[model samples]
Target: MKKLQVLYIAAFFAVCLVPFVGMAVTGQESSSENRTLAEFPQLKTEEGINVQWLNDAGEYFQDHFAFRNELVTANALINGKILGTSTASGVIQGTDGWLYYKDSLEDYLGENLLKDRSLYNISHILSLMQEYLAEKNVQFAFTVAPNKNSLYDENMPYYDSYKVSDNKNLINLQKYLKNENVSYVDLYEPLAKADEILYHKRDSHWNNKGAACASDFLLEGLGKEHESYTDETYTVKTDFTGDLDEMLYPLATTPEDEIYYDRQTTFAYVGEVGSNFDPRITTVNPVKTGSLVMYRDSFGNALLPFMADAYGNAYFSRGIPYQLTDVDTMVADTVVVERAERFLPEMAESAPVMPAPERTVSTGEDKADPEAVKDLEIITQGNYLKISGRIAEKYLDTESRIYVRTDGDKVYEAFPNDVTLDDGSTDCGGFTLYLPVGTATEKGNLEILTGNDESADIIFAKD
Candidate 1:
């Protein structure tokens, strides 16, 4: 009996040592979490002994342990398949094997809607972008890809004490865009009315067929004549793996069906082509005539092939502060900005890097109080000068237009948007304008003007 007890103790110790032995023999496994694994921790650094060595070592072992992927897979299977829930925090398990991205939850429920000012800011920003492209003789259109659950909420599980709000950010933004006269494409209605399933059960984006539908709608909105895929031959391939699936079940083989068209490829990549997530991608189609510059997000992945086929020269970008200057450089005939509905708030977060529209404002009202404008700054940014500052909230309205008048009597209208301050906080009442560096010279005084005709002056110096 005592020998049996000793044998059991030995077996336990052997099991505990197996991971260490396997790690030493096979080395650390590559990460499947869509992020870099933690590096081996150092006991000392150039500064001195590493104070956080213990914590860093713990994270390293957690990421690099033997059989970690297999173990994670097994746990996910038990939780998702058995317990009917997701183990990954970024994924939300839905009914019928559907998985929704957790980041889209707030938009899905219509909670945390953007403020009226923010909606105005988004509309105004797009309006300014449209105006900029219009001046260059480039047509511009904007669209939002609806969230997965926004159109297919039937598969979503009901959360306790939460109900969908009628006033969603997307709805508000659409209203504001209409008021601002921006060309907006409504992708949600058609996608919602489609007969067949357009989105994958486990993916966050639309399928190829859905992308084709969106492409058709967007091209129509742009007033461009393009081929219609109403009867295009296609095959539903079953070897597609979704990103959400990867995040949720790293080791499990759960492939979904993806529609692939049989059309001959005509477009050619201009450079080393990575995946669709590359920051910049350019395509040229010898058979097509017009050029297009599309600022898009992940939804653009599926739309890339379709758009590339329609234009002679096409530039797709996933970068922010969108380089609208590309329209001029590429001699583009059309520009489109596509964003997901879940990311509407980002429209108000950063002002697009473009020259502010010159305007003639009548500075007839009384000067604004000195305390009304705060933290005003004029900094040189490349060939343009970035002027940004916050105004007293009480002086601003949803329709308020912020303008900057240089000492030379040149006035440029600012985009009504939020700007990130030096300390990493967003000034909600902030306005930003970009002017050509040649607009002013040496030392001068600048004036801030609002739609209400109130003005404030600031002394400035240029290096």
Candidate 2:
């Protein structure tokens, strides 16, 4: 009995020690979490002893331990196959093996819709961008890529118990854009009416086929003549790995079907090419004529090949606070802004980096109410002076246009945008304008003005 107990104890100790022994021999495993793994914890730092060493060590071990991927795969399999749920926080397992990105769930359920002001702000931002591009004779069009679940809700797990709103951010934003006369492409209806499945079952984004459809719509909207690719032949290859699949089962192989076009590509990379997610990528087509500058996000990955093929020179960027100056530099014939439906709020979160359009607002009676405008900030960014602040919500309406007056002489219209404060909080009443630094003196008194002639003086000192 004593020998049997000793053997059991030895087996338990060996099992517990295996990870440590294997880690020493094999080193840290590569992470599949779609994020940078925590580094090894250091006990000391330049400042002093590391106060968070214990917590950091725990995170490091959790990320680098031996058999981590295998164990994670096993756990995911049990949860997904047996319990019918996802183990990864960022992924949601749906019916028929469909996987949806969790970040898009709010849009799927019609929850957390953007406020009316935000919708107007989005439209105003696009309108300003359109006006700027139009000055350079560059046609501008904007479109939102429908969320995977928004179009494929039939495959999504039943959320009928949740309170779904009739008004969605995408639908409302489209209405505002239409009212503002901003060139906007309606991608949702066309994508929804398509007979074939355009999105990957296990991926958050649409497949190449969907991207082709969007590219056609965008090109048509811009009034640019380009290849429709309607009759292009493609082969369905079953070797595509999905990001969601990799996240859920790091050690498992589950390849999805990818439609690979058989046609030869006409465009070539302008320089050393990285992955699709690079901040900037340039391509050129020797046979094509016009130039294009497109500001896009992840959805642009699939659209890149098609857009590049259609233009003589195409510059695609995923940078935020979009550098609209590219249109001038590229002498672009067309500019397209593509954003995912789920990220609509982001449009109002930051003012795009562009010269504020000069405006002439009638001088209004200066109101002595100090509470009219709050939290004003003036900072220099690039060649422009960024002035942002929040106005009392009571003084503003959907049609109230925001304008900034410098030294009570020059007037510039501001985008009805929100500013992300230092504490990470955002206010819908925020307004931002970027005036050329030389055009506006930083030490001068500024004033906030509304379309209704409401005005309040601003006191600021430049550092």
Candidate 3:
């Protein structure tokens, strides 16, 4: 009995030490996670064993813990079998091993309620883009990619633990867009109307066939000819682990058949580094009929080959701050802004521009004087104007009023929303405010009222 007890004690400590020991033997990065494994924490002279250090150490240890991947997979299995939920991550295991992302269900549930101003915001941007392109005699389209849950809501697990917002973001946005005279292609119906499976069983994005479907719709909608792809040329491989599957079970995952389109059917490009974001693609032998400048995301990856064949010169960029900054460089006949549905709010926010660390500071000494509010970027979102930047920490009182002076001394209040403390790289926090609807004019200036005695002007230009 004594020997048995001793052996049991030894086993427990061995099991406990195994992770630390194996961590030393393993590589510094995880193949499954596709990220660098945590390094041993360096001692900070100033921080010295504070909450920050301890928290960071805990994260680093957890990240580098040996056998962590195996343990996570095991936990996922146990949770799926027993709890009927994924506690390991936000991955949702659905009917017949169809995994879905938690964000999809959250968006469908309206957990992250897109504000009404967001509709006005996107429509305004699209209208501006359309008008700009029209001036250059360039056709433009804002193609909204359909959300996965929007189509396959039945596949999602039925459990409502979040506050659902009553905003029908898409319907409301579409109605507003039409009123604003912004041209766009709606892929939701066309994708749904198709008889064949358009989306992958395991991934958030659509499969090759779905891309083909969307591409076909876009070509027809834009008045371009559709290129044919025969099944004899394409190949299919089965049981591929997808993006959602990586979240749920990264190790030894199950498979689904992936269709690969023919690779031989596209044009090559001659390019210069126009943006630090993507090396701008210009075809070697330009086509006569059309040219394109496309701002796209991951779903656009599948559309690339199809688009390359159709356009003479095509420039594809995944850059944020979706602007006309690259217009003169590409000289395209068509301008396309393609966004995944969930990120519609991004249409309002301009891409952030920050100077180098040395240039970020003011030239004079004692530049950190307390001010009521420091304005950052300002742009119009139709009737509402959004002002974002930092506000003095002391003046961050919930009731502080920021307003705009429009139509010659007419005062309109700006309501702040989604303000976050310690958001930017500074002691002061950041805020976003939408000037109330119907307060806009052809040209006007905004201001912040700092108590009764003082006010600061906010200057902004759409260009």
Of models 1 and 2, which has the larger TM-score? Answer: 2
Q: Model 2 Cα displacement at 350 (Å)?
A: 1.8
Q: List the residue pairs that clash in candidate 1.
A: none
Off by over 4 Å in 2: 1-10, 159-163, 420-425, 452-463
* Reference-based TM-score of each model: 0.90, 0.93, 0.72
Candidate 2 structure quality by residue, lDDT tens digits, 31-99? 678788999988999989999999999899888889989999999999988888889988888888988
Residue 48 lDDT (model 1): 96
List ranges where model 1 is wrong by over 4 Å: 1-22, 34-49, 364-377, 419-427, 441-443, 452-463
Local distance difference test, per candidate? 0.83, 0.84, 0.62
* Model 3, CA-based lDDT: 0.62
lDDT of 3 by residue, 94-201 (tens): 665666666556567766555554455457556656765787798988888877777766666666424386344676688768977888899999888777777888
Error of 2 at 55 (Å): 1.2
Candidate rank order under lDDT: 2, 1, 3
Q: Look at candidate 3 and give me any clashing residue pairs.
A: 239-255, 239-256, 240-256, 287-312
Q: In candidate 1, what are the lDDT values of residues 1-463, reduced to their tens digit?
A: 9999999999999998887888999899665675678999889899999999999998998898888888888999999898888888888888888988888887766777778888889998999999888887889999999898878887786661165675678887888999989999999999999998799898999999999999999888888888977799999889888888988888895999999999886899999988877889999999889999999999999999998899999999999989777888889989999999888888898788899888765665655567778877878988887888787777677778887777747778888877567897666678887877888643576667677335423322222
Error of 2 at 85 (Å): 0.3
